[model samples]
Structures are given as C-alpha cells and as structure tokens.
Target: MASSYVEELLRQLAEERERADRERERANREREHADRAERKLAEEREHAEQKLAEEREHAEQMLAEERERANRAEAKQAPTTLEQYLRLIQQRLVTTLLVESNPVNSASGSVTAVNEKFYPLELCRWDDFEKQLERTFIEISSVFSSRSLFPSETDILGVQRELSPTSRKDEQDIRPFVRSAIEKPAERIVRAYYDLTNRPEKFCFQNNAYSLEYRDPETEIERRSPSKRRSPERKKSQPIPDRWGICEEEGGLRRVCVGEYKAAHKVPDEEIRQVLDTASKNLFLEVLWRKQSGTTNSEQDKAKELVAQILCQAFHYMIQSGLLFGYITSGRTLILLRVDEFAQQRQARESEAQYAPATQLATFALLALRAREMPRDWIVQAENCGIYQWPLVPNPALHQNISLQPQTYGGETSESSGENDDPNDSDYGASQRQSRSQPDQQSRSQNERRRSPRKRTERSVGEYCTQACLLGLVQKSPLDVSCPNFSMHKRSSARGKHPITKDDLCCLLRKQLDRSLDQSCECLDRKGFFGDVGVLFKVTLTEYGYTFVAKGVQKANERDLAHEMKVYSHLVPLQGKNIPVCLGSIALTRPYPLVSMAKVTKMLLMSWAGTSLCYNTWPEGVDIKKETDKTLQTLAQSGVRHDDIRQSNLVWNAERQRVMAIDLQQATITSVTKRQASPPVLHTRKHRKIARSSSHIKGIVI
Candidate 1:
C-alpha cells in the first residue's frame, strides 16, 4: 500500500517480498525432487532390459547345445567305415566257425597226381594289413562314403549266417553242408578282402545260388531218352560251376577261377598230402608208380582212382572256364591249387573226344617242367614286386619274364586250433629239406615202412604253397600275350555295333512305364543316387541279364544333359580311352519318378565307369593325377572346357581299362565352327588419301 502507510508500507512491502521469496524456494525444492524421481525410474528400466537380454542369450545357447548332443548320439549308433565292418564280421565269423561241427575222418587215399607249384604269395601280417586299411580308409572315405550306393545293411551278416544247413546232423552225411557253413562265409570274407587292402574289386563271386538255372532232378522221360536218336544238345545240363570268380572288368562276365567243395571224408588226407608233396615236381608219377608197386593194397588203389577221377573233373572245369585257379575245400581242409601259366589245356568244347587225353598229357608235361625247373629264389623276389604270387593270372608278360622258382617245404604242419580266429596269425611257412632216400637202405614192412615203392610221401602245407605265401599271388591278374580282354584299348575294339540305336532307345523309353522294352525283358533290380539336379540308377535287366547305368534329369536340367550329349559326341574318339561309351541320349515320354522329380524328361544311357576312383580303388601302375591332366588336355583339343574338375568326377572304367571323365554337366564348349577368315584388305591410293584427310597433323608432323 502506498508510501504512507509509508513507514507502515515499507514494513508491509518487506513482509510481502519475504513471502514471495519463500514461495519461490518451495517451487525450486519440488522441481529438484521431480528430476531425481525421473532419473531413478529410467535407471530401473535399463537394468530390467539388460537382465531380460542376458536370459534370452542363455536360452539360445542351451538350444544349440541340445542339437549338437543329438547329432553326436545319432553318429554313434550307426557304424560307417569298413574298419568297423571288419570288427563286426570278425566276431560273427568266430561265432559261426564251428556252429554245426561234425567230425568224419576220411580213410587215407593215395594221390597219383603231383601237386604243382604256383606263384608263391607272401603271407601278409594282419597288423600290416590293418595299417594299410587305415591309410586307405582315411584317404577314400572322405570322398566316396557319402555318395556310395553299396547296398550295405546292418543285418547282412545275420542273413548270411542263416543260409547254413541245419539238416545234416550225421557224422557221415554226404550232403553239401559246406554251402551253408564255409562257402557263404568264405565269399563274404573275399568281398571284405578288397577293403582290407588297396586292391580293386576285380572279382565277384558267382555262386549257384544266384546264377544257376536249376531244373527238376532228372525226369524219367529224359533219363530214358538218352538212347533215343537225334539228341539235341539243348537237352543236356549246362556245365555251370558250383562256385566261380567272374570279372566284371571285362564287359561279359568271364570266369577267372573255380572252387570245388566236398565232405571231409570224401577227400582223404593222404590224397591231400601226395598232391602237396610233388608241388615242385612231377605228379603223374604218383599214379604210375603206386599202380606198379606190388606193395599197394586194393583198398589203397581204389582210393588212388577216387582222387584221380575227382581231380580230372576239376581240371576239366578249369580248362573250359579259361582259368587255372582251382581250390578244393572239404569244410575243414583247404587246398588252393594253381596250374602253370604257360601250359595250354585243350578246352573240351575245342577238342575232339579222341584227342582229349593226348592234349591233357601235353598240358601236364608243361606243368611238370614248370614245377621242376622254376627257381625258388626268383619267386620270393617277385612276391615283393607283386609278380610271382598265387594265381599267376591274366598275362605272364605283365610280370617280368623271370623264370619262376619253386620252393619246397619241410617239418610237420601245426593245424590251426578251432578256437584261434586271429587274422594276423603269423604261422611261419616250412623251409625246404633234402628228401633223397638212401639207395642202400633196405625196404621195411608195412608195420615199419620207411621207403615205399612209390616215390612221393604224404606232406602238408609246405614252402611256397603255404597259405601265407599265396596272398600276394592271388592279388595279381595275369594276361596272355594275345588276350583282348586285358588290352587297354580293347573297349573300342571289343564293342560290337551299338547295341541299341538312339531312335530305338527313344521307342524303348516310351515303354519304360510298362517295364518291358524288348520282348521277354523284365526289370530285375534297380539302385539309384539322387543328385541335386539329376538322378542315376543302375538298372538290371532280365532276358539278357545285362546291367546298365541310367542317368536322368528333369526337364529343368535337360539343357545340361543336352550339352553333355554334345560333349560326348565331341569326345567320341576318347570313348574306351578316357571315358565310357555313351550309348546315347533319350527323352522320356513320361516323367520318371526320382527323388522329388515330377518330370524327368531326359535320360542318358552309358557304360559303367567302373567304381569311383580313389586311393583305394586306384588301379596299380596308373597315376590318377597324371591321367587327369592328360584327360583335360585332350578335352581342350576337342574345344571343350570341363568347368568342374575334381577326383570325384573321374572314375575307373574297369571293363574299358581307363580312368574315365564323367559328370560333364558343368562343362562349356568352344564351338568348333569352321568359318573361313576374309581376305586381308589392301591399301590403295584412294583409301590412303581418305585416311590422310581424316587424320589431322598434331602440332607439326615431324
């Protein structure tokens, strides 16, 4: 209030100013408190958000760990490698070795045929074999294990074991107990053999179980008709082998070895002994001298004839099959026999009945010379070079021309115990000992006989014939100097006119849905590999019984196939050289069902490029890297570029005998158009003047 209340007003104004200051102080305090509260709320929110983020991260990590554990568990359950397979089979073999054991001792039979020496194979140390297996497994498994269509099963061994016979319980039963017990197991072991070493799968067992065209036991009408006129050869039973090894490496399955099985009592130990005794000498003398010897009993003479007839039968099979590797197994006892490589046996189909004996005698003479004259030391050395080993097979020229040596054995052979199933059994082979009987020694009675009239005595597995020494010999494939099957270029030479024309193939594929192309044809089996853009199936056909690999692609990737067919056409000269024979291409009338393929409109038919090439499947003497380089160079010359180059793309064409190039899908072609170049333009005065007019002088035309 105005000045007067001036004295009073001053006092009142001061009081009012004091009140305003107090109110201002109160407002500042409220604002400071609000700022502090807001800061505390924001800090609490950030702390909660950080805690939530940490929890989320921890949950994700737990999920990842769970997935890893599951994968590891799955991997543990299925055995993948051959090494693992070996362990599994080893146990099964041991368990089944003597499941239905029956002992029947055969009476001692006389042997008139001498055992001939063969390429002596050195026994492989089981430990060494394992190490070799490990090396090959590491190198090859990483590449082929995933894409393999090997048809492996966990219970394959179980199925194999069940194939044994349970009917023969008698001690003297003369049934084929071997088929169930030993033969099946033996075949599996041989199948596993390729994996145990670096050897390629050159052989496949052809057992009667698969290939035999069994007919009813001789009918009364057929038996009575033998004497009837006009005996058509078709009525006769085919001479198919009980067990034989066939090489698919040659297009047609060719028998390379034979096996004969008998009861333990059928082939006597003495017969076995005599065969091995003359392994490095003549065999015919066994029969000749024993028959002439007055000391031999009638029973012994009968035994001699029994063994002779059996051998003669086995020999005939070997001759006709065009092979010399023959084995005689009687469940318990195993006799691996190999004949001389150079000897010429007259095939029954090739020779007249009257001339057979003379031809056989000539064959025996050559075998006798090889046994008596081959140097033992040379054979031992050849074993290292993989030359002089059992089944000196395929061609003689492949191994050096060194005349082989035959080693003889001494000492009593220790029979492997029934319980001993060790693979690395290092049973030492017996060394040679002098067997010259003193000419002055007097003959003793049968009760105490030392020198009998017969020249040969009973012997066991000895010298080079020991099982240990035969492993290497069996690995090599021998060849004759004139053999077309062994020639590298034989693929082109051996193939006849294209089995089916492309025009014919198109018509055939049109009928694929009905499962019949040619008459009487049936799809026996099929195995397939599903690829990213295509599919491949190995189709086994009946009637002809030929197996072909059919490669197919959907309409989307048909362009790739078209380009591949064109590439194959350019590579026509290389067929049977560095690639397989492309039988040609076809378009399916219908969409073929493959992995996720609703429309497989393209098909490619080609020969098998053997198996995948790797350190394990590599053919001896072939350097894959060098071969690959050459293959690429050849492709370049043909004006093609293989955009995809890898070891996996190269295959071993076993039948064609070459490292083949495959999977030409990613390839690009440099068109080999032969258009001529235009003639060079000549400089004329008019053209020169025009050029001078167009050209301006830069600065000064020095």
Candidate 2:
C-alpha cells in the first residue's frame, strides 16, 4: 500500500508540471500578439505625421508660387492708366483684406458684442452717386496724371500678410491689418486729385487712429432717460476712426475724409446685411433703430444692438468732426455716408432739441440718433407685420462739403468744422467766398428745404457692397476748394467784406430780441469745441448773416473769461489781422441750441481763427512757422508775453491769412508796453535798423 501511494503522488506532481508548461506557452503567445499590435500602431502614426508634414510643405510652396506669380503679373503688366492701376489695386486689396470666401450667415444667429448706444439717424442714399462729383469717379481719377497710386505688389503683399498665424486665429487685433491693407491704397489714389486739382497741396494720409479725435462728449441725455442710457465706457486712449484722409494745407494736414474700419470676423458681412434694408433697390441707405417693443425677439434684439454698436461710434464721430464724405467698412461691405447739415440740424430741432436749452453743465454729447425720454421705436419702421426695418440707409445726393478743421494727429492743429464742412476747410474759403455774396439767400434756401423723404429705405448695399466701393470713395476728394480754405492770401483778400465794428457784425442775438436765441441764430456747430473756461460755437446770425465763433461761458466761469478779455485788450492792435477780431461780449437773453449749459449767459464773439498748426509742411508759398513766430514776437513786444508757446497756441487765422498765437487765457502781462498801427520809423541820416527793414512797420519803438 505504501509503494502505491508514492507512485500516485509522483504521477500527481508530473501532471501539475505539465499543466504549468502549457499555461506558460499560452501566456508567451499572447505577449507576442500584443507586441505586434503595438509596433503596427507606432509605424502607422509615424507614417501619418510624415504625410501631414509633406502636405503642409506643399501647400506653403504652392502659396508662395502663387504670390510670386501675382507679383510678376503686376510688374509685367505695369498698368499705367489710373483706372487700370486702381482696378489692379482693388483686386489685390480684395485678395488681401477680404478673407472670407464664404462667411457664415449670422443674421439668424448669435449677435456680436459691442457697447451699444441706440440713436435714430435719417439716412439718405445718393442714388446717382456716380454722377454727384464730376461724373464717374473714374473720370475724376483720369484727370490726375497716374503717378504710382498703387504700392509695390511685394510691399502690399508683405504688409497684408503681416498677420501671424496666431493673430489670424485670435482675430482680436484685426483693425491694423485692415488699415494697412486699405490705407495706403486709398491714400495714394486720392493724392492724384489734390495734385491735379489743388496743385502745390501735397496729398497725404494720416493714421489719426491713435490720436485724440475729440474730447469726451457730454452725455447728460443718457442720465436723464433710462431708455437712451448706454454705457459711456469706451477706449479712452484712442480716436474712433482707424484711418484719415489727410492733405497738406496751409493751416496743417487737413482731414478731408475719414473712415471707420472693423475686423471682418467681428463685423461680418451678415451683420452688415442685417443692418441694411435689403427690400429696396438702392445701393446705399441709412438705418436708425428707434423705439424698443417690449415684445422681445432675442434674434431681432441682438441685431438691433449690433447695428447700433457698429454705427453709433462713427456716426457721432463724423457729425462732430464735420466732414462732407465719410464711410464705415468691414472688408466685406463698405457704406458711404454723408451728413446733411441742414437735415441733421432740422432733425435735432424737431426731435432731440430739448437737451440743448442749457439748463445744466455744458455736457453736450451728440445724442443725434438717440431718443431719450420718449416712447421707443421712433427710428424703426414697423411694416405692420411686426417685422422691423432696423437699420435705415439714407439715399441722399452727396452734397459738396462745407468747412471743418479737424485737430491734427499732434493735437496742435485742431480745426473745427462748420455745418456740413470738411475739417480742413474754413467756411471763408473758395466755397464760402463764392457763396458769401448771397450768403443769406443760399442759407435760407438750404434751411427751408428739408432732407428728401426719399432718404430712408430698406435696401440692399447692392452694387456698392463690393470691396471695389472702398476704392471708389478715394475719388470723393474735396479737391474743388483751395487746399487751406482760409489761409493768408484768401483771408486778406476777403477782409473788406467781413464785419469791422461790433455794430457791423450781423448778430442775430441783437437783431431778434423778441425771438428765442435758438430760433434767431443758426447753429453752425452744436458741439464745436471746449475751451479752457468757455465753449466755442460756430454760429451764423440769421438776420444779418454774421458768421463768427462765439466763446461762451456759464455764469460760474466768468472770471476766466475776464482774464481772456484782458489778454485780448492788450493785443487789441493785432486784432482782425494777426489775431481774431473780438466782438464785445453779450449776456444771453435765452439759452442757445447745443451749447447752453445753465444758460450760457455770456458770449464773446470773435472771428474764426483757423485751427492750430501741426504739419511741418504747408501749401506752396506759405510759411506758417515764420508767420506765427512773427505774430508771437509782436505779442511779446505788446506788453502781453504769451507764456504758452506751442503749436496749439499758434492758431492759423484763415480770415487774416496769418498764423497767430491763440489761447491767451493762460498768458501773462510781462511789462507795461505800447505799440502802434504803423510806428513812424525815425529815418535819420544813417538808416536806422527799423527804417531799413523794408515793409510797413507796425510794432513798438525800436
């Protein structure tokens, strides 16, 4: 029995060993299969990466080749004609600036975020815009000898492609790219107009984007009405527009036209379309979304907010800047806009005129399109089907620009504008002078005729929607007038016609004591300028047709006005020629429109001094620096040593055709001094230094 047990035990052990061997063999086979799968995956991943890299390289190479081809073609063609060159430039810009081959339709989707200030604007579309200014723009450009209007293709491509891959993906900093792409093209093209039409006035472009465009507009209306209240928070460091159409004038580099640009991604084609009235046949139109229905359609509200966001900024900017032609664009669509001064004024008088009665601080913000304290929906058209025509595009004929003097990039030469005038233009220029003879008649006719009712429409951008339209505005140059509207010679030549004595001035306030001040005088500018202690207004006395800038201050700030008065009194001899002629101050019987804060009771009238000097270069035969220096030197000799000497102080007096130092409110009287209209030079046997200086001598005893 013991022997049998041992044999069984050995057999059991043998069986156990065999079972272990079989398990080991199975585990080894499984390991081998797993390793094989792992190797295959690694090999496949490596192969895929290599293929992707190759594809990327090929795409880059092909793009480079295409760019080379485009460059070669541009150079080889050398399109000499202005139209041809412009077309080529437009094509290249289209290729560069417009990146969306097929933008997403956003009209039905999420709205873009922007600070919204809802305002009503009467938009007028220029139906025959092609005929408004010297027929077709092509013809206007044709008059210019085609010099190199286009930047070199290589340079253009390089600037256009400056966008980094990260920036393209991020899309936050797209304005620079858009500006770089179009600024040079539009500017170079416009140069021909100035060179050909206003010869000796060099055409240039200024990036006033970073410049101080205007002071913070008084936004009291926002506080008064909850419906019109919008967050006034905005970028404080920069100006509104991205680009400026500047030309060298005697006063400074004049801001002719301005443009507001947006990132294509931020302001998509669909959003622009959403704002436009597509039901009509016109190419351009204006939209003002007024009144909010409590019935909220999230989609429509988003659109309304978006449209207001995009337009309110630029609309207010153009209004304040006083420009004949201005535009807003996102690479996909361009909308040309013109401000009808009379129409805009009428609208204000009829609609938002209540705030300007001057019951508070001179907080005059441009609430032009906005409705405060009113039942909503005044700007929007309810088609009776609960369908809202949100953005109204105005189709008004592009009228000739009047006069505006914009502050230059340096803030040294900031020329304010007259109603419907260009910033660089003074109302006393060629246009103003020609119309001066019949000033009352012309103004009356304009004031009587309201803006055409044909202005607003629910229309598609149509033909003007193309990027080519961006280039088309290049021809809307205000080249018909002299480069510097009221420079030295022009002012001196027209001196006889202007008011000499205070009584000679055509003052509406004095003539119409029975009527309200607002009714009697025409407000050339609502928010013209903010002085140290007083607000400056461009006004036309309606009764006798006296146009002068009124320096107004509230009753509280009369002390500062006294100091300014003293300075003017000291420099009395330099009045009307070297300095602005002071028309005596008047206490207001009633509040004025747009500028009456706590009833601006005192107004010191003075001839319009052209804006400050900013440009190093002036129009041919003009030396602004020399002229201004002489004026300052003369001021120093006249007991009044103008302590403040800067470009801003040196005002270019267009009426007198001289650059005189202004803003003497901060000036000091250094000593008791005396001067003469024409000091009798003592001509002795030996010629005195003063006698030898050939010219009509007008200064202190030398």
Candidate 3:
C-alpha cells in the first residue's frame, strides 16, 4: 500500500508542473497582443489630431476671406448727404492735420486740434463759420493724406483720429472758435493765396491796401471853392444812390450851393474809414475778376480804372475831412492830385483805345487804376508792367524821392511846373529844330527823283553780259589796278567772231579737271584699284587705255617693251603709275591708237621693271605672293592651322611666265582627328597641281 501511494504523489506533482508552464505561456502571448494594440491606438490618435488641426485652419481661412469681402463691399458704398459725409470729412480732416503736424508738433497735438476745431464744425450747418472750418479741415486733411500718415490697413476715420487736434494743441488754442470756424475756409483761402501769389506779379493782400484817407463814392463830395465853401442848395445837392446807402452814412453837411455860392463836396472821415475797412474784400473780388478774365491788358486796364476811382473816392473823403488840408502839405497834395488826375485820364483814354496799338498803354493805365481799386491788383499789375508800385501813405523811401510843398493846391502845382521847366527847355528847342528839318529833306528826295529819268526798254544780252563780265573782271583784279576799258573791248568783240576767250577755256578746264580728279581720286581711294597688279592693269587699261605687260618682241628674244600701252585710245583712262604716260608714235588721228617700241621700252624699263626688281629683292618671309597662296590653301583645309604666310619666297618664272609658290619644307601638316575611323589622307599633290594652275601658285626657279 505504501508503494502505490508514493507513485500517486509523483504523478500529481508532474501534472501540476505541466499546467503551470502552459498558463505562463498563455500570459506571455496576452502581453505581446496588448503591446501591438497600444501602438495601433496611438497612431490612430495622431491621425485624428492632424485632421482636427487641418479643419481648424480651413475655418480660419474662410473667416479671413469673409472679412476681406466685407471690407471691399463697404469701400464701394458712397456717402451722399452732408450728414453722411461728415464722418468721412472729419476723418480726412484729422488725417490731414496729423500729417501736417508731423513735421511740426506731435501726433497727439494734431489729433486734439482736429477734434476740437474740425469735428464739431463739420457736424454744424454750412455757414460762414462752418465753411471756414471745412476749408481748414480740407487743407489739413490734404496735407496728412499726401504724407500717407495712415497705414494701408487703417480706414480714413482711423487716420483722422491719428492726426487730430491732439497733435497740435498750441495752434488750436489761439482763437479757438475762429480757428475752428475758419479751418475749412482757411484751406480755400490758402489755396487762393497760392494761386494769386504764384507769380512774381501776383497781387498779394500782404503787399497792398487801401489808403486810410480813401473814401467811398457815396461819401465823396465835389468842392466848388478852395476854402470857406458854403453848403450846396437843395436843388443842387445830388441824392445818394440806394446802392451806395447799403454801406455808407450820409450826414455831414446839410446842403451846398454851386455856381453863385461856394459848394463843397463832402466825405466825412467815418465814410473814408468804412471804405478802407471794406477794401480788403473788394480788392479780393477785383483780383478774382482779373484772374478769371485771364489777365489781358484790357482787363488789367479796367481793374486799374476801378482802383483809381476807389482811391479818388477815398482821397475825396480825406479832403472833406480836412485831413489833406491839415496834415498833408499843399505841394504833396498837389502832386498826389496830379498823379490821380493823370491816372484817371489815362483810364478814360485806354477804355476808348483799340486793342492792337494800345496794349502797353492800356496795361500801364490798368496797373495805375488797380493801385486804387484793388491795392493788391495795382501792385501786381505795376510789377507786371515793370514799374515799382509803392504804398501812397507816408513811407521813408517815398519821402526821400518826392517833394512836399505847403502852398495852396493850385499854387503849389504852378510852382512845381516852374521848377521843372529849366532842365527840359534846351532839349525841347533841339527837338523843334529837328522836326522843322524833316520837310526840307522830303522835298530834296522828291527833287532828286524828278531829275533822273527811268528806262523802259528791255536790256540787251550783250550789254548785260558785258556788265556782268566786267564786274567779274574787276573783282578778280587787284584793288590797285585801274578798271580795264570794257567799253572798247565790248565794241571789238561785237565786230568780230566771238573768240574762245581765256574765261571760256578756264571754265571748261575747271569743269573737266574737277570731274576727272573726282573720279580718279574716288577709284584710287575706295575701289582698291592699286591692291593687285592685275587690278591695277585692268583699271589703267579700262580708264586710261594703258596696261603693264612683260612680253618678248620676238620668240627667243629679250623683252623689248615688257609694259606698254597707248596713252589715248577711244578714251583716256586714269593710270596708277607714278609718271604720266609719254605719248610717242601714237597718232591722235588714227582710229586705233598704236604704241611705239621706244615708248613701250621706256615705260617697261622705268615702272614695271622697278616693281619686279623690288618684288624680287623683298625679304624672304615678306613675299606677299607666297603668303597669300598659303593663306588660300589653309583656308581651303578643314582643320586648325597657322595663318603666317607671305610673299617673299614667291617668284614669277620667265619660262612659265606665271607666278609660283615655294618653300613648303617648313610647312606644318594639320591632321584632322575622326571619331569613327582615321580621316582619309588628303592628296596634297593633286591639290597643289590644281592650285598651281590657280591664282596662288608658288615659286618656280626663274
């Protein structure tokens, strides 16, 4: 029983060990599967996160596109009403102010000024105050916009705020209300100023003004007597026009009688003051009118007349006030009155003057008139006329140049006229004498014409030709030489056959020589006529019927005349030889000119022989014939080769009587390499034979 129990225990132990091993193997497999699952899940999570990010990016891009579209749509909308445009104007004004202030004050100062001055004014109704504000705003806005004060992304409103009154506080503080009201109009006024004052002759307000004494026409009175004038009677008193009453007060003297009683035209000091005060506006209008009319002399004249009238009215006012009588000396008043009357008369005359001849006069008259009506226009017109227009009031410069007297007005004028007489008397007398001599000179011219008779018949050719020929002869002769007896010569020529004169020969030779020289020089200078002996021979033979040749007179005999040709054949062609051809044994009467043996010998022995000797004696390497032949052969080959060829070794064999090339012993053989197979050897002997027969043959021992 014990043996059986032990055996059972062993079996149980074996069974338990096997089961535990199996369970351990199963757990190991489970962990490997879990690891694979975790890796897969992580990859999936990563992909999902990437997808979410891409979707978010797409949504943001869509939103951005929507915003851009909205901005473009808004930009297209227009603002029509004043109220609707107020915001835009305000914004623009602010921007302008800021830009202008950038070079001056801080941005904040500009913003503050715009806000205080422009914003409120723009919101208000369009009145003078608002208009002025608008003008200022426009100017400020323009300045800022021009400077690109706002970023591209920023709207106009944003730019305005950026460059508002805050940017320039100091400027905004002084006359704050006026500044605000005039800001818009200030721009208009500034633009007007630029336009008006653009030229050197422009009428500028700062340069011109109505005199303090100048009065309105409504306030001016006519003076019948010099002093202690009585009031005009009711019948004589002129009623003030209604238009004049608009700005004038008429309550000085009740009445003044004319003729029997002393009638003084009166302009109270107050009226003068009023006119002077209004002159600025009136002057501006006048300038505007002149500008509109395009500144013609007529317009200028009209402006001057208006100015003079205005000044005269002002002066009259001063006279009535007794200011001219008390403060101004009589002499000065008289001068002023004279200048005034002169200006008035000029204006009246210019108005009646025609356009053509009176342009300058009208211009001056207009300028003078402008001085009174529109002080600014007057100054500008005077400047345009090249005159210095100064203020009529007390100025140091004027005082230095002008005389001031204190006698009665009319008496002072008389005294000044007497003072001016002495210097001008002699000049006046001289001018009178000159004027009286004019008629006598005219009578003398008439008498001279009457004494000389005129010819009506046509001039004869002989007479005309004789005179022309005589004049030409005189010109050609020395100044010291007396004029030849042309009359006697003319009579002799008419009595005989018209001789071929020296002049006729000279004229013919001049034309022939000029044409021949021109042709010869052109051929020599341009056509390479002397480059080759062949070309030289051809040109000489064709042009001058002369050619170079080396030939024996008889077979086996030395060359009698190697180079010879007739000097003249059908035509005389230009030859290139240094010496002209000698005409020998060549009958001019013959149909075909024949050259003589002696002449041929001389030409050949002289020029052609010299040329051959020089060619033979040339340095070995300097042989042009050999060099030229080598050059031609090398050019014919299809490989790299040297071009150092020349004529020294080349020779003309007397036996062959043809040029030949020599000295090929130092010639380099240019071998062409081939990709597929060795290139075929060129048969140079065959080419040489052909080339020998060709123009570039090498040397043959003569």
TM-score per model over all chains: 0.30, 0.42, 0.17
Off by over 4 Å in 3: 1-16, 28-32, 35-43, 46-54, 61-86, 89-702
Error of 3 at 584 (Å): 98
Cα lDDT tens digits for candidate 1, 584-640: 566664444321112356667655555555324766887777877887888788777
lDDT of 2 by residue, 461-518 (tens): 1110111111111122121122222232124233323222343342445555224343
TM-score leaderboard ranking:
2, 1, 3
Poorest stretch of ten by lDDT in candidate 2: 357-366
Residue 620 CA error for candidate 2 (Å)? Answer: 24
- Candidate 2 lDDT score relative to the true structure: 0.41
Candidate 2 or 3, higher lDDT? 2
Best by TM-score: 2
Cα lDDT tens digits for candidate 3, 241-358: 1010000001111000000000001111222222222232123223324444456255333433333233333232222211110010100010112111111111112211121111
